[model samples]
Target: MKQQVRELFPTPLWVLDIPPSDAAPFNAKLRDEIEKIISPRPNVPSGSNWQTPHDLHTRPAFADFTKLVEISARSVAQFLNVERYPMMITGCWANINPPSAYHPTHNHPNNYLSGVYYVAVPEAGPDLIFQDPRPSLIMPWTGKLSPLTANASAEQAVPGRMIIFPSWLRHHVPSNEGTSERISISFNLMFRNFAETAASPRWKATAGQE
Candidate 1:
């Protein structure tokens, strides 16, 4: 899976081509609904800010979305030998970049997993950059290659594709250099049902998270 560079990072990262058969009409309807919510918030950055859609959890389209993440998580969790599988929908935020707008490099705080479903990816802008998290953990003695600073290795933004990875992974999108808009939705997730499973216990805070 590693190509063009040494394995510079750990943690699972996946670019899934979600079937997206019903996505055209679904995307159309989704845009309409999102517009309604957004018309009121004219100052909001659709590409950067996450505005939760109405009935996102109960809506059929969103249910389908949830199913996709769930199936993916179950497969990965079991493969990784995780304890519980109560993935929650932290929130779903849509992004529509008009010209030069782009999201900054950031990781979801206080979450377990994060995902993005791309609805539209116009040419010439916004590449999701995955950087080496441990730039300082390098061998002091130089051998074959000069160590590079935490650098972006690749950029991905294709329609009907879903990218899921651990929430803590630091990722960013380069500023949109293209003329058209970019559309996508980001989400956060965490396990919910642990006590029932009895395999592992969830972390509990005593008066404080620290």
Candidate 2:
């Protein structure tokens, strides 16, 4: 007899590393551009020291960065073998987490994919922690086990690194203990519908007539 094993329902997490040479300058330029036009908004649901309004993707200054993010998102969709429709960025925003600032566990809603790109991360910046989405699987837990039964995982943030995951996954960031701010740009992507595009012209005409 031969031994057999199988693994099911694996989650996908993609990480893209941008060379330090390119990342260092790009991050500095982006930080300056963000400060010039966007004002910090209070009471952000994601829990940041400061968060920009969720319209960064529409700004002219972010045009190049937006293109890069879209490329990365497309790669993720391709890896998942999703070829039915084109994926596009629905929104983008920035978060500046100062010391002791943290984000509570939450997931992006109404989007197929979500991601974050590190613009600036201090040496001791907090890690990005993810929780297992399936809660029922743990009902039979008898005792703390090893990697085979682990329910949560953490990834350290690196400057210029990009991470993409399913929007439904629950994840959060721990408190930033470093002196400097941990800056990151987050975005969401969704599939585009042909019907929506076809109706745009008619909608425009109707609005003009009204």
TM-score to true structure, per model: 0.71, 0.82
TM-score of predicted model 2? 0.82
Report lDDT per candidate.
0.68, 0.83
Badly placed stretches (over 4 Å) of model 1 are 1-9, 20-23, 44-55, 58-61, 137-150, 194-210
TM-score, cand. 1 vs. native: 0.71
Tens digit per residue, CA lDDT, model 1, 2-96: 66866554566877775568667666666676676567655755444344562355566567666776777677667667745566666767776
The RMSD of every model to the true structure, in order and in angstroms, is 7.1, 8.1
Worst 10 residues of 2 by lDDT: 197-206
- If candidate 2 were superposed on the true structure by all CA atoms, what would the RMSD be? 8.1
| Model 1, global lDDT | 0.68
* Residue 134 lDDT, candidate 1, scale 0-100: 69
